[model samples]
Target: MIDHSIDRDPARPDVGHGHFRVDEKRWDSTFFGRQIGSLSWTELPADRKAGRTELGRIAELSDAAGYSLVECHVGMTDFTLISLLEDIGFRVVDSRVRFLTRWTLADVPVTTPLDGAIRWAVPSDRDRIVELTHEGFTDNDKFCSRFKNPDYFSAGDTRRYFEAWIDSTAFEADAASAVLEIDNEVRGYFIYQVRGEYEELPVVKGILTAVAPNSRGANGHLAMQAFLYHRLGLSDWFLDNTTQLTNTPVIRNHIRSSKRLDEIVLTLYRRPAA
Candidate 1:
């Protein structure tokens, strides 16, 4: 049997660092109103048996520690770890794909109402952005939103969580953040953080993009994107963005803009067997 060890973080007792560990997700727990945990360390453990042993131990320990669920996000290419997680009863919740868009700005003019073009997000746009985030994310009708799983999260919890998330980061961008205004109303917004630079050009990572439901079907999405591109200065930054695997509009736009596929992430969750 592989020896199980725990790491003392003073603030957290469930954290460990050997083959695997279950790190308490205090933020998520507070957000969802429960004790939640996550599998720490993304890399696959060297010994498969040891990893399996620890996975089981962590599940039991997490349950005893009051965590109602444990979540893990791993690269889709890591089949070995996926198998181990599946073997230990973790279930897939969401798959997200990151695309590398050398051109983070859209090429097509894709015109709409002149008022609907994207502009830099301001402090006043916080509430609208939060509302849009809530509306855009609450729907699990077509695609499975990661946090909307009935087994783990409540009906309105996911939307509120995202609303709070975007609210927190609404105007707090590392490099640049922009919004789409239509008829003097904020229709959508995006946040770009500079990860660093690539040979003088900034490496910008698009962290969040959301469009209001009422703004759909009018080429507004592309229009806002193109405006963002122009606003940031065309073809001058290394950019990458991620979207849910089932997000067809973004996937199509990424392909049309010549953005190559970068990576795929699979999110899984585990809980005590009832």
Candidate 2:
């Protein structure tokens, strides 16, 4: 998801004053057919004045290094970076939201899914999962995500992203995935991960989820939530999910389930001018 792998290598102090680093996003580069890079906290300048000058240098260096696109994310309240980002032509493309589930399930009512079944995902379900990945999210969705930006990502690439996400994060420690079956056929899937001691408390994150086009209705979404609430209610882990605000299903679930809005991040993208 958020790629929190920032430069925490004790080599720099405060991510430094006159330093910059752009991590090459290999997956994004290959998927989009262009050199894509991302700026980390290490690249953040000290002040607005330094930011204006340093960020401009970062852009030029990135272009000289063959990066045609660069991305960065900062807290929505970080006005210094926001203004500096705008100075260099970065436009907000996505809003990353963090919704926290404090404890037990909220007092929201959900419709029981008709003929829907849920089970932990197994190796055999890979092919069916891929099939859904390709067909589940379509143009008909209220909104998909950062990957669905047609100006930069093709529909085919978007599907590949979902496939890649599941493949890459499926077996990490404490990761669990569930598949939703409708009428005895696999129609949706979601991944959940728990960090036993992340941030000094057990933290649970909703990694991602997808439902087949045939099952994108209220029943399908509620079924997944029912499963999530069931699992979350079992432990006292600090549960949360970072999703695009435009993702209607998740936003609805947050409101319906009473998940508090804890944080909001703005993801900005800048493409090299042709």
Candidate 3:
């Protein structure tokens, strides 16, 4: 297991208030020494001073490692501290509508019938998921380019992308992912992690979801959502989806299908050489 003890700040009053943990790991050469992962402070109480101190440490390390990018998803309820992050220069790379739909054994909806089949992913599905992910990006040239960019997902970097997802799923299956198949073909998938205590309110943190071009319709979207709700049975869940404000169709869909929970304005700041 990765050693988180080094980053742990014991005296912080909000340390575990909201299931928050200050964890950091070495970044790969691909990220140029920049530690490229999240710091989970969602469970911490909203203390501006504490939040700033924690973020300052992160910013210092990121700068030393030459990492210019940092991304995080905070609970909608943690407004004060999230705003503090913006003041420190970490730009909101993207904003996703947080949506929740309660469920019970009785409230389970019928699976949306589609051309494809849905099932839990296995080791055998890895290659197919990788292939579909790379190919699906082609439908949107701009989207593909972001990944293809030298700073991001370059051509043939599919291995890293796929491996990241695989590793995440292996580490936490409950909140990891589920795949969508069609006639035995892997067409799309969703990656999430179960959070919160069962005794309290349970929530699913949806990290990523994608559908192949051929599967980009209401059927495909509904199928994926249905599968997650039915299989996971998470009563309260949140989906942090990334989309441009200009994308009217998607924005409209999120507003309609998922209740708007919070809005965050992200801005990136580049630090001058120390």
Candidate 4:
């Protein structure tokens, strides 16, 4: 048996390491009527056996919980563990790339709409926002596959996931949910949260942003970006952005605006209840 001391490394910051968990809520298992488990971890015990044992335990527990599949997120730097996971039957599904931007007053664009438009979302906007979210994420990076495998994932599942997000974001006090209105109609929306601290500097994170497919050319996206940057820039906050690797449009836009890629994550999956 491997010593548990690996988790208490004195040389590494307590928060630097990652953890593995089964997030049932995020996957909409109850709504979808399917048990899906998410496995994530940052550091592995030096004892490979222990790491494998832990993963095996997770798989077993997921099976017991009636999970049909287990999704695992592995960072690029953790190749050793990746190889181990692959050997144990997990196949890569999708990948995520994390980008970071240090927003300041200087980074704010002068072209952003200065009008007193762009307001926080209200209860009346929930249905439309959910619809927009469902449409925007149908081809999301996490499950972006040309195979069109409904058994693995479906548009209905995507809608359910966003429904949960909208429901939860509405109740989060630290969250900022905003929508762009043109001619008194919502065209785009964004969800952000004030999270994390580095050297006491606050971090503003964008959880989701989407423009109605039909409204793409109306500058709704730019308006949303400009509004958030200007708002966060006022506090000299650092910005964290994450997107799936297949989201070329969003990635290209961020890069064009000077966002730097910080990390790449690979999400692998094992099916048939482990």
Top candidate when judged by TM-score against the true structure: 1
Distance (Å) between predicted and true CA of 194, model 3? 0.8
What lDDT would candidate 1 get against the real structure? 0.71
Candidate maximizing lDDT: 1
Residues 1-274, model 3: lDDT tens digits: 1121233444532222233443333333243344443445545545667767766665665555444444455545665665667766644444444335444545556676467676666777766666665555533444522224444344445346445654555346466556777777878876666656433666555655677777777476566656777777545544444454445576678678654534643322333234
lDDT ranking, high to low: 1, 2, 4, 3
Give per-residue CA lDDT, model 2, range 128-222, as digits (tens): 87776666554446655777788777788777777777777655656777788877788888777875554466677877677876677747656
Q: What is the TM-score of each predicted model, taking all chains together?
A: 0.79, 0.77, 0.59, 0.73
Off by over 4 Å in 4: 1-67, 110-117, 139-149, 153-155, 231-234
Candidate 4 positional error at 107, Å: 3.2
Give candidate 1's TM-score. 0.79
lDDT of each: 0.71, 0.70, 0.53, 0.66
Model 1 residue 162 CA deviation in Å: 1.5
**lDDT for model 3:** 0.53
After best superposition, candidate 2 residue 186: deviation in angstroms? Answer: 1.2
Worst 10 residues of 4 by lDDT: 1-10
